[model samples]
Target: MDLMARVTAVVGGVMVMLQRVGAPRTQAVGTKPVIPSARKQGIMTLKMPTAKGWASGQLPKTAPGLKVNAFASGLDHPRWIEVLPNGDVLVAEAKEQPNPPKTLMDRATQATMRRARAIGVSANRISLWRDADGDGVAERREVFLEGQNQPFGMALVNGTFYVGNTDGIVAFPYEEGETRLNGPGRKLVEFKPGGHWTRSLIVSPDQSKLYAGVGSLSNIGDQGMQAEEGRAAIWELDLASGAARIFASGLRNPVGMAWEPVTGALWTVVNERDGLGDETPPDYLTSVEEDGFYGWPYCYWGGTVDDRVAQDPQMVSRAITPDYALGGHTASLGLCWMPAGTLPGFSEGMVIGQHGSWNRSVLSGYRLIFVPFENGRPAGPPQDILWGFLSEDEKFSYGRPVGVAIGPDKASLLMADDVGNVIWRITGV
Candidate 1:
């Protein structure tokens, strides 16, 4: 057998061993140290639950006094969501376009992605769902826009609607309650794309600038720093003049971003590096600072040097610690703050949709969680609001939660589940 075949055989054996032994440790949550216990270099554990759709008359379990129901179904990989001023919900139905493998590692990565159901042709469209009668379910669904390059993040400022496509930000003229956008949008800025393709966009509080999160082209800068220009950082764009600049640097894969209502500070959820054992170097939710660096490809969790990379003592010393650690390899993607007085017991907190894990012996995430906030910071332990996406034996998943947003009534929470092709609506009883 050739090298690729031999490697595959070895990894297959390792998966069998892991399934028998179970996870090395229970997942760690919140801001805490995940002590490094390195495994053999270049040998990664693969553990992804097989995707299974919900059974008939089945629904996700929710917290007491809260109800869970499908707001819309049969979507084509709905990944992100945005609510408009006129009570309309916009869903970004997209998937990553497959890339040709150039090396053995590339092929291995693609194999893992396939098992996780993470790779597919892009839908390249956004759909609008309106609940006109104020019922929990959407009464109208229509294609709002189409023919875009893997569009993700979306925003509206004044009369212009902006979309953060994989390669750039584009804008379309829009009016309230309009279901279709016919004209092609003009590009505001271009981005270098390779590794992390999801571009998350949000407008500043003052409405003068837009912020777009562009992740790194490769994990730990394996493609060299030159290939990483204008990536792994958030870019601030001036709405009036179209000028742009880097807002923050050294974040490996920042996905979901939101502004803290009390402090007006920007916050983001970052998917950290892998292969450092199942526990070390946890993924995190942090407050982003202007001109700040959060230690990617060098150090992690503030000053804990990653010996895998060429060490830079000065840069390590300058690294800032994250505000909270979600869990290693959990792939936490969706983030949105709860509007006060929306849900009785869950008001004034942040809702996070963890898309689950693929690099460990056991699964993590795959549910929606709530973290209570006080004085503009996370205050209490994460509360499980919606769960049971994974099977009882943990070998299969009914769905994986992604983007989250407050519903039009401001009382229900909307979650985008890419795997099950369903949008879930959660409301207090």
Candidate 2:
């Protein structure tokens, strides 16, 4: 096998070991260190390379004790992936296109449907898989649910599976052997969709609140703040009462989120406002304080006023700048904190998946990164943990990694790729 294939095999092996151990659902929330003088330098940043689609056989040089692997393949737009208590991976595949325009029915409409049939979508469902051994191929594949309209993010809390889409939130009874959703599921809540309608979800550590990340309906529009009634904010939903309220506002488009175990702070990976040429307002990973305004149209990173939307003097005073800016157009998504017992360098750190960029003339991201932490917070720049998925040509990428979760064995990493429809495992040498 080639070098990349070899790495993939090694990573896959580690995953199999984790699966054998029965991936635990015991979360590490509110375990952050209580340090008084931990400094936030805001100086270090990642030097990103332009992305190109590399073949599956190539590999990057290893970092002392690190090993890479390609575990599984052949998926259709797999978005959020979670490891169940029974060693199976649950994946939400948002198969259909978002907000497709409906053409008035006529002879012309039929003709258009015929022409669009080649490019249109068909399969939309949730999948479950088991990897018996640590190698790449899954031993079992089963469909858990079907007919979901653009299902993106998923959270499994105490045997209850919560799925998020553009329109609303839904929940279903989850068990180890229960594949293919048949019974009537409960609809949690609904929201108005607009310009950007991807709803990413994360359940609070206490399991009392469900924080859903809603993107702005329009790119930039005349509706302005009014169109943003529920847009660009992290809406907090009470799980028991089913009450929905805006949690945080003016985030533009917060895609991925995780609760910091040590500090109990909510951190979100934001895909900032686009259309500033290539690099204007940078994408970010920051603490989502309750009721904190992030300055969507009025201000940007570090209190810089945006020229596109003239800032109202009143809104300016309300918006707080981000904690840390990842980079301009980096497309940062899927963040996870390294547990206290995993690895040497990244024990108390963060791992962010850069899904790569589309708006730029040159491609970027498409790699897994490690953000070092000291005490309980991020201390340095994000390092490339798993690369080589991008090639030298920059035309296409072999994989686009989305969600990331640490394996149960405490030694390997589990990554979900929506574009390639595969899950990867990474281990240390």
Candidate 3:
């Protein structure tokens, strides 16, 4: 375009890099994270490593009593996963659609996303992995489904398989031992697409309904409340009538969901808002209640109002505080329940895949971690399951953990690493 515009863009990018600060170590890891007072920034922090897949001898570090191996590699950005009753596993190779930048801030965001490999042409496909003989390593891989609109999560209930595509939930019939879906599936429910576009899916224990996570279209109603209709919440879908309703509200970006085994309560990991400094409102893990409001544009952590949005006192008063904090800008996106003795040194708890962050100078959540549980609630401090995804200087990401699940063999942990384009399997040493 023009010489002046080019110069202005370069100057703005340089300023962002110069203002970067090391991510401060956070104590925001438990039911009582020490939250600092609000310190908003006129220009949001923007620091991220360029995406570099694992080098020839490179691998992630694991906890002392555990070991990790590449269960499958050379996959497209595999971000979400599902396991079937027949012991097969599925991983969705998806990425963000390239939304053209409309403003200066949008241009900056677009560039950051590109460096992080969080944006690109999505494969728009799902691949199946199999480890017959109950082995930890997958011995077979096949195309299970393809040609979908940025599909993320998958589920198989009864005889129908469901997919959480960006614009809608789709269904296809399946039979035992089949390796692929035959046709374009029928849409079960329509949803607003784009923005925080990953739609994660989980079925009820009894297989009667499915729950999907739809994140907001903008950070804190920047596009106004009307643009956020039926967004930023968990939706429950009835299988019989094909009906869906908001199960919980105000969960800015709830990506991963699991049921607390003992209490049977639904729990989720939510990514909180940005531009409020490094650690004002920590990303969190909390049990979601029916019809409960947890505060998004209006408030956070229960009654703490966000003055950026138009005030809504009554909604703020009714906001529910999350049960535990996971650290600021960690982008904790994947969650799955692991029963007691699933791994050595770890008891029953949730496995979280922290997708990490770009809005903060200091990085958080490039690894996998376990949060201990007692009687179906967060019990104590978290423990690392895998690390070393980031280089020592933190300027390059070899991998970033995302979707997590327990293997059908009931002994190993499976993690999807989008940055490295591999699926990792962890088991006791």
Candidate 4:
């Protein structure tokens, strides 16, 4: 190894030691309220488990009364899934866009990315998988769209297919049951490029508006507020005119979003800022309100001041408290609501695919969890539905769950395991 490589190894070893000694307070899960406790920022306790492919005949463990199987195997880093009206599953086989290292920190970030298996050339395509036999596996597959940037979120409205690229939203012409698009798509809107790059897109129930989740350019506006112009919040776009406006602000890294079925409220699962120890401001699930701000750099968990940033009492006061905490550094990403009677013992709730954490000693997330809802809000403790992504020793991971969606029949759940390069299907036993 060269100089930087050797340096990274030494630093990684020290970090692992720190993680072993760090004491994380509080069990970070469930719907119950949690108190925010900020820890002093210093050495980052990096604890990413090494990625290990699944062994032969290996599968994720499911909850009781549920069965797990591979929906589509051998995908090229599938990151997101969109179930079409005709029962076709659209998977974005994308990798992170190339962001060359410019500084020492950037180089270190690149090294971390390598350890997480997050660095690679973009596949720049979407694949369509069809399970005509309902046998929990896709029998037919085709390339639906190709030659695009790093695409993540996808949505179809009024026969117009929308894709969320790292830097913008694009739309393509579509017809029911058609396998592929004939031409490159038109760019709907451009976004600022920086730290967090995944753009998650969802359409309004009335199909009149589009909501795009854009993350911040840097952690806590370290790159200046001007660089964060249209980031760290959700954007509302008019589908007809393409006009867009910021719907909410101060969200650090909002990823997965869904509309609450009973209340029609907009909901999101946010991945909070790290370097706050293990138990300080937890990642959260909350209902998004128009013009509301959830504290990012300055505060967290609704008004708990993060001494790391400049204090603004007024801004802190405006920060809205999240509805439920999903534990600190869980990296909670994918969100989808389970309709009534969709799955036994899991109906009328939200399922979150936690891609897992890399910033804490004790690894959190890395599985699928179900949070029950009552009267249109989170009402009970979270139950793990899919787990065992990590190895028995917890030092390596067989897979990490990302985007999740309910199947067209609404009787099964689909999860994108980026590390495993497989889409897993879960159904009632």
- Which candidate achieves the best lDDT against the true structure? 3
What C-alpha lDDT, on a 0 to 100 scale, does residue 117 get in candidate 2?
A: 23
Q: Rank the candidates by lDDT, best first.
A: 3, 4, 1, 2
Off by over 4 Å in 1: 1-24, 37-41
**Model 2 lDDT per residue over 1-429, tens place:** 334334433443343343324322221112221111111112111122222323567554335577766555677766676667666777777643434445322222223222222113635577887777846446788888887766777787887888886778889987766766766478888876535656788888888888898888754443666767788888999988888999998888898888777788888888876554334556778888899988887777646666667667677778886766665556787788777556544556778887765434344577888776675567766677777555666534666667887765566777876555667777776
List the candidate numbers ranked by TM-score, top first.
4, 3, 1, 2
lDDT for model 1, please.
0.85
Clashing pairs in 1: none
| TM-score between model 1 and native | 0.94
Q: Give per-residue lDDT, candidate 4, residue 319.
A: 91
Per-candidate TM-score against the hidden true structure: 0.94, 0.79, 0.95, 0.96
lDDT of 3 at 312: 89
The sequence of per-residue lDDT tens digits that candidate 3 reaches over residues 1-429 is 244334444654565455454434565768877887676767776677778889997889999989998888889999988888788889999999977788877777677677779898899999999988665778899999999999997888888999999998999999987889979999999999999999999999888999999999998899899999999999999998888999999999999999987989999999999887677789999999999999998998888888888988999999999999999889999999999999999999999999998767567789899999998889999999999999887878999999998887788989999999999999999
For model 2, the local distance difference test gives 0.65
Please give the clash total of every predicted structure, in order: 0, 22, 1, 0
Please give the lDDT score at residue 319 for candidate 2.
84
